[model samples]
Target: MANMYDHAYDLEKAIRESEEFKGLKAAYDTVMNDPSSKEMFENFRNIQLELQQKQMQGQEISEEEVQKAQSVVQVVQQDEQIAKLMEQEQRLNIAINDISRIITKPLEELYGQPEE
Candidate 1:
């Protein structure tokens, strides 16, 4: 178990050093450093988190909530810095998703194989 935990920490370190994470960090810094983009990005993120939380709680997301998120997204999309930040975020998410899939592959193969 200790060795497994050590390996997990190593994986975390590797992820932090990865290009995807570095790109995300750079884009995030750029967005945060710019006063104009900072507020917009933060609001956009808050709205996104709220919507996600609502869904996770099994509560219905109203049309108004969806529209609010969409409007914020539209506004953010128009800002170059925010757009770049979003692009980097998507790349990082994709990389993390791939890692998650890879980690679960053995379990998936074991449980998902069709019986002969």
Candidate 2:
């Protein structure tokens, strides 16, 4: 029988082979090859991480914080390569989330739905 580690490795391999992952990698490479796009992408990522950290810490996420992240997203959406990368990343995220849900189904069924 396959162990948990073997299943994990297989999942990783599946993700690496997914079209969404490939598209994301290609889009990332294209952006990294351009100085302006690379800078903008990094800035977007930093702002996103900051907002996420604040949320994780139970801090009140101010309207300004949300606006700041939105502003960066607007700018990112203007760049073709970066926009494509974001789309691909979203697709990959959805796939990963699906996997998470599937893996947790049994536990969730046993314990009932978790609080949002």
For candidate 1, the TM-score is 0.88
What Cα-based lDDT does every candidate model obtain? 0.92, 0.90
Error of 1 at 30 (Å): 1.0
- Across 28-66, the per-residue lDDT of candidate 2 in tens digits comes to 899999999999999999988888898899999988888
Among these predicted structures, which one has the highest lDDT? 1
Model 1 lDDT per residue over 41-110, tens place: 9888888898899899999999988898888899899999999999998999998999899989999999
Pairs in steric clash, model 1: none
After the best TM-score superposition of candidate 1, give how far the Cα of residue 59 lies from its true spot, in angstroms.
1.5
Off by over 4 Å in 2: 113-116
Whole-model lDDT, model 2: 0.90
